[model samples]
Target: MIFIDYLENVELISCGFDHNFSITNKGEIYSWGLNSCGQLGLGDERNRNTPCLVSFPNDDLIDIRIKDIVAGNYHSIFLFENGQLWGFGSNRDGELGLGDKNNRSNLTKIPIENVQKIACSKFHLFSLAHDGSSYYAWGSTKYGNWLSSRKLDGQPASFSAASAMILESPITFGLTSKIKVFQFQEPISTKSIIRLFNNPDNYDVKFVIGDRRILACKCYLKSVSDYYCLMFSGAWKEKVEVEIRDYSYETYYAYLRMLHYGCIGINQNRITQLIDLATCYIDKRLMKHCKTFIRDDLDEQTMPTYLPLVIKYEIKELYDKLSHITIEQVLPKVTDSILQNNENSIEFLDWFYNQRRPFIPK
Candidate 1:
């Protein structure tokens, strides 16, 4: 039963690539297997033939109503009810960030409070707290830099032998005074973000710093509907005029909810009709996420396989990041010997460099 659970209360189960698993119910975290580098918090360097309890200090006062669990390449993390975090199994590279390289013999308490989410990486962890702040990287290289730069912690990301580029965390421009929060997931349009500051549609767009008291009612909506409500998002010093028809409202609401939750509650038969009717405006972030989900999750044979074609149809904010460069970098290194008096060969590099600057007319 080395890989099988013998624990009676093991109500849920999940296993990962390295044959590691985190099993729990209330708030308790348990694991077994491949303790070679101490990925299992079972103390000794021996592998357990069955699951064992990975205890927490607060276990005495709580039933371990753990909110969530995730596994990485050689590590694991779980969220708790008290907003605290707990992790064990693999402390190498300080991914466990207890400020030590020693294996955490059992479930060790990570004093990160008010955590709303625990994002586990191959050897590191990411914790997003309730106050809209984030914490991460008690493990691994790439995840650490990504997490550090996420909080605007100032260390520029470094290129490593592992050769992966971590994306920057979303940046928030500090507000001078009280104002509304405008948030959007990835599929959102560049147009919407700009609309918050100034509407290009030729209308006078403005916000007022009223009462000097910030109204911190933050709402980050997923679908197009919440953005729809943004028509009333401005600070009003006078009466406002807005018009939204019934069909538009229902369609936006349904599309918005679907994009947010990965589920739509609208009538199944009318979904096609809704998609067809709601063509005028769409949240760009929603459209992108849908395309990504389709590409990654769907098989390659899927006709509308947006995932496989994502890189092809991708729009890069910085064109250099459009794709990994092989020939572009290598071509510069190629000597004139390879170009030996061939006029056609000389023209090739000129055309290639010009191609790299994507702004010009193709």
Candidate 2:
């Protein structure tokens, strides 16, 4: 049953049997229900029917703030915004990273640091660290393998932070109760937004693009773009007619679509356009997503196309990442023609060679 007094400012929620855990907008934690094994972090195994604030001792005096929460069969762990891990629960199989099977009723700080994300099961724990360059696991060793000592591969995409909430209307008594809904959104090429555009009651403004006019909501535009926020926040003229002449119609539209939704269709044909547009808008998040796309799609044939954009944007992080993938995958096939045709790749090669790191022969 959903509680009538639902939590406010909650960013993420995790649940265990007879209990619930949540991280709030201020990076504070709240837990409700069973505390049989001290999972509630209330300093005792007392059950709380209503949500109770859970906090570390002197939390305000410390630099750590909780950002994520996960739960096991009877245990719970919290991940801090600064990449620290702490836990309080039954540790029958060392699931708490405490290196022992000891039960703790209070939040105990773990030694692990630089942890970006954490996950746990009934008898195991998994942590993604260094933004996913490294992974660490601990807990019940089973299936005849020491999974705890093994390293997992792949880097995680840039972290985007946002707060979301679910709103519920008052409960009605009858099955034939009214269910009226109201939502206003913008028009875009994406199929999801296309249908919303067709609804005459949706848009609040229109953005004229080339030969076509795209309808949009002023609130949405302001939410995603500082430039648009300034323009629509009573700082500029209140005229309904407005024309954007900076970026091309296609790129700007795609950018807007990305802002409305969380994704965009990207390929070799339009990757550069998106990145350039993101750069112009100073949208580091969008730019990071585009770079991650280019990183994953990097190949010997595609490196030429990607390298120039890396250089144009001065993306040193991506430049080094591309160099690492290239050297690790296609070093033996490197040819003089490949180097001659791509100057940016040549620059990467020079940087790689100067690193003085040992490279094993293929």
Candidate 3:
């Protein structure tokens, strides 16, 4: 029998069936067990009975810091602090999200970022973004569609054709699906990158926004967005230069930061502007953040300003939160004339009565 006596002074962070993974205090990943599909990341598909050090590729090996490990039946996923995701092992069903069904024997970095958690079940993989607003998956078609249905909670969602499917739902009420488009960012030093924006060392695309420029890798865009994927991946494509006119530099940069950092800081001052941009870009996470900020910061004085926004955006959670506060704090102080004059106030009153009125006693 093989013994893993060398695993001393190390903490077992997580484990999976027929495989074991651990992280040292210094944040190094070690794997053991089934390697039929190179799930051990050992550069080969041979199973090992003892723990072995999983090697990462040298080209992208700079500042290699792993934050989490997720293992499926015959595959493994690694998440890095710099919003990078690496996968190894079976891709028979495209569980690695590599846009194909080719099994990887070596550590292959996939084009995705800001992934908070990756749930690997029997044959399904689900990824949740750090912003708590988006979920992604690429696995069995049945599983992906099944989870999408669960996310919709009986609501309908539109299906689109992409390596990884994104189920678009209605954009109103609490039923709106919160989703995001992720991108890739390397941890390489600035000196290594050829340009700040235009065709940066390894980047494939550039977007010009007035005086400012944003550099990006096209892999994720092709997998996530329908427009760009169709444009660049076409057989007739020759050049790639995109002019972004829908969003200002500040808003555009903010969205980029969300892709790189997993979360972006936003203040109440820029909430409305960011919300508009998020809506235009179909960035539901940022939209949700804006609504959450407006809802959490609401009070008696700011009620008029934010309530209309809540109603307009159909943010049922925030609407209910503000409604509860209004019932307890604002309603008693309101005069009959104000309710009679304001349409929103009247609607609120009607809903409030319906909620507060008790049914027949049992």
Candidate 4:
């Protein structure tokens, strides 16, 4: 194992496939390892076995305090505390966000400002705006084409058909509305509460899903959900084992986990089912979480699939928000064959067409 003894008070470190970079608490950046692509940002293509300080151009007036750093396969991006962004290294794919496909050995300032955070892959870069809503992306257009589907400044996003050309500069996308940040209430003690979840030792009830049986606590379940409170109080109080139907084991377990641990492990695949369960149980917290995911992360590709759910579940907030989407904007992303295969997608298309019919000219 290599030990970096010379550096002190290291605040952050990011590594690429062959190179690495570290930032000190005093805002000093040190880099080492491979330099074949100048990812070291040391102003030369020389590999370093020891850490070397990365310097900025003398003309820069802002202080060089880095808030975050990310190293791509052949590039490095730095986000400054004052919201300025800088990058270096390979530009063959335009990952540097410099508006040109020229490699830079030294740090170069990116044109866009008010950057709060940055993330990168092998040949692309993504930056989050200071407002925590809009996202800016650059680098390979192969992946960046997703941005073309979104409406920018109330206008449909347009892009060239040429896939060979890279997105040399950052382009903004995602929801225009300010993102709603949800703060989950901290549990009294996470470890102990989490231990009680699915633990057979002191479980008073067992919910059977298919052939599998899941252990749970009655008192804790009752405390978190009114459905559990009502079920455990009346004629069903003596029930020790209950058979669950309709929902899968994973979805049910995630629901129980939320009630016990105050959070759920959710993804796109399971979000729809979880939302249905939340709606059936009248769980406002889970409903809000589901709505937030749809509202903030909704894109043209997913709008077709999710629009039906938004309407079916009566998610007024998202329904109203998605009403702005035009049929022309989403129809191109989905073909008639794909739509015919899905009844929900067909339903959404019909509903969306009628909603926009008044605006379309005869």
Best by TM-score: 4
> Could you give candidate 1's per-residue lDDT for residues 281-301 as a string of tens digits?
444544443443333222212
lDDT of 2 by residue, 170-227 (tens): 2211111011111112322344544443135787777676776666777667866886
Task: Tell me how far candidate 2 lies from the true structure as C-alpha RMSD in angstroms.
Answer: 14.9
By lDDT, the best candidate is: 4
The positional error of residue 341 in candidate 4, measured at the CA in angstroms, is 24
Cα deviation of 297 in candidate 4 (Å)?
1.6
Candidate 3 C-alpha lDDT tens digits along 270-336: 5666777776657666676677667545655456767777777677777677777778666665655
Candidate 4, residues 1-362: lDDT per residue as tens digits?
13233665454566665777776656788899889878888999999988899887786634657666777777887877778878888877566767677888988887777765455654334222232334455665545533211212322222211112234544332211211223245532266776777997879899999999889888887887898899899745999998989789988987887666554545556778888998888898888878877775565536776888888987788765565554454444455646567876777789879998777576
lDDT of each: 0.41, 0.59, 0.58, 0.66
Clashing pairs in 2: none
User: Could you tell which candidate, 2 or 3, scores higher by lDDT?
Assistant: 2
Write down the TM-score of every candidate: 0.37, 0.42, 0.40, 0.48
lDDT of 2: 0.59
User: Model 1 scores what on Cα lDDT?
Assistant: 0.41
All candidates in order of lDDT, best leading = 4, 2, 3, 1
In model 3, the Cα lDDT at residue 308 comes to 70
Better of 1 and 3 by lDDT: 3
In model 3, where do residues sit more than 4 Å from their true spots?
Answer: 1-4, 59-61, 123-131, 143-362
